[model samples]
Target: MALLVPPRSRTGGIVALVAHPDDESLIAGGTLALAARAGVPTGILTLTRGELGPIGDPRLATPATLGEVRERELAEAATHLGAGWARCLHHPDGELPWVDVETAAAEVAAVLAPLAPAALLTFAPDGLYWHPDHIAAREIALRAAALAGPGGPCVYEACWEPETACALVAAAAARGLPASLWGLEPEAFGSPTDGLPLTRVDVSEVIDRKLRALRAHRTQIDRGHLFATLPDDLGTAHLGVEQWHVAGGPGPDVLGALLGEAVRV
Candidate 1:
């Protein structure tokens, strides 16, 4: 069955290939919202159902249940953000136990040929927070990109800028804030600070929507820590402006350069 709830599409289209349901919110929420607000078409390709998550209930994360629940939530989040289509490749959540790169890449390639997005979003090799599933998702996207051909879509990595990351660290240190939120490590604490460059995307328009989506994943973000200390506006203020490391492009700033526009936010 088709996973997405169709939306009213606009001129330009964007496709985001990610590892899980919450990933679109955590990583590219703002951008997805921006595309929707602009009336641009936006779609998401989540490679797995996130069934392997370390949640307390095993039954809740079952392949059948988790897949459908994830699909439901993803569709809702997309509608909330005005995104276009949402679909999953249905690959096993954890280690395939038997899948190879070429096979997975072929699955992704089939989707790309039809979507033909103006821009594509996915994880960097670092996998942002170092989730193994995320790393796999990145590889799939890269291989799919190659098969789809260079001219298919402008790929964007959902990543933090090294300079901005360092600044975030300074901000946390100067403020005497703990290096975690809800027991989750601080965004800048352990990530590579430099030597890895990135592109910046201004997602100010839908920052509020992103926050709402994040909250929707109550299972993950409810542990209560840094997020509680900062007001929603303040927290989202940081998320409003996003950054990415472009894997293949003229450079990190290719989006701004190619789009010929920059958001002041």
Candidate 2:
């Protein structure tokens, strides 16, 4: 029997390989939605089922079954994001960093090779918020890129621009929440301000779908969650834009073409 509701897809064009169930939606749902809208087939490859994540409702799942529950949620969330396919590996959540990246990369590359994706999307070095699983996801993606060699799909890292991150910090402070959050100092909250300019994706049109995708991860985001409570217009205003930077390129920019944004990768 399949461990998840859906088995790995035999084909794809644009794919987001990430650490957990919601990371794909939280980071690249809009992009995937846009790609699907543009007739480009989209997919997701989650490294883990996010067993360590929150149990939004007691009725939904228990700690022991969270992984199974999340695998199903990932499928639903991927459909909401308009992806052609969704799948996850059995890697232990929260212990991904302990896995040998070489073996992990081989697994990732094997799943990705036949798909011939235009772009490979994953976390940056900071892992977006420095989660160990997220960092490991990045390492895996980078190694997968290396395995594919010069002709490989470009790796685009989902990340926060320093200025935007600071603004978010300020927003939290304005809302009376701690400026420093997620175990990192306020100043260390995002990618370094310097380096290659980041690419901004205007996800306004598909923002609703993005919101829906977030909601589909029912076990992860609940009523009190910002995503769960967000009004469509407000969601647009707050989550309308997403950012990415090229980790390496010289491959295909199918995603960039769909977004009308150019990247060195």
Candidate 3:
């Protein structure tokens, strides 16, 4: 594995496409924060406002208003991560696969045309935990990246390092943490079997920022949730490094240049 060296010149910016409001924060917030701290303009486009997600508090939002509430929460999270902007598409939650791919691709392309981020981050084909919306978002993002042509942004998928993820899951289980809180069942918590090249970005410095961004999505995350309950040392051990697998675009690895120090893992 070769270290991904940072680019010599800043090109455009970084844009993350996600299926729901908190996906950006949960999946790649630290990376976004790191990029922002490095003076790289960063943004996020959530395909849906996560209207179907379980509400943490009824007082915060009702069914009819959950979409709006989540949208606002996403914005706050993005701001906390130092993102330049955050936008949402009104696709129905849990039904993104039903959306017309061409239409979704066009909408995504439209968003990318203006910003032209050097790197486009989104879920892997497996959708991390095999969420339908995540899969759909990844498909749409890939289509949009293709539409962007030769000079388009490099596409990267948020990924987990298998051994490390398994260890974390075991540790969490040992602590009596509920799988539901982390959105994973004990049997389901591990990296995919397919071995893909990975880039690991050390985000220890921005872990606090990432936690704040996660907390900002109060509508989805409960006070006693796994994210909030993890001891600081465990959190650092599990979340300090964000991992990405190149999904599309040119070169073996281009993010190191676009963001900051990154190494092959």
Order candidates by lDDT, high to low.
3, 2, 1
Q: What is the number of backbone collisions in each predicted candidate, taken in the order shown?
A: 1, 0, 3
| RMSD in order of candidates | 4.4, 3.7, 6.0
TM-score of each candidate structure, all chains considered together: 0.78, 0.84, 0.88
User: Would you give me the overall lDDT of model 2?
Assistant: 0.76
Which candidate would rank higher by TM-score, 1 or 2? 2
Q: Is candidate 1 or candidate 3 better by lDDT?
A: 3
Residue 140 lDDT in candidate 2: 93
Instruction: Give the TM-score (vs. native) of candidate 3.
Output: 0.88
TM-score, structure 2 vs. true? 0.84
Best by TM-score: 3
lDDT per residue, candidate 3, 54-116, as tens digits?
888899999999988888888888888988788888899999999999999999887778666
Q: What lDDT score belongs to each candidate, Candidate 1 first?
A: 0.65, 0.76, 0.79
Model 1 residue-pair collision total = 1
10 residues in a row with least lDDT, candidate 1: 222-231
Clashes of 2: 0
Top lDDT hit: 3
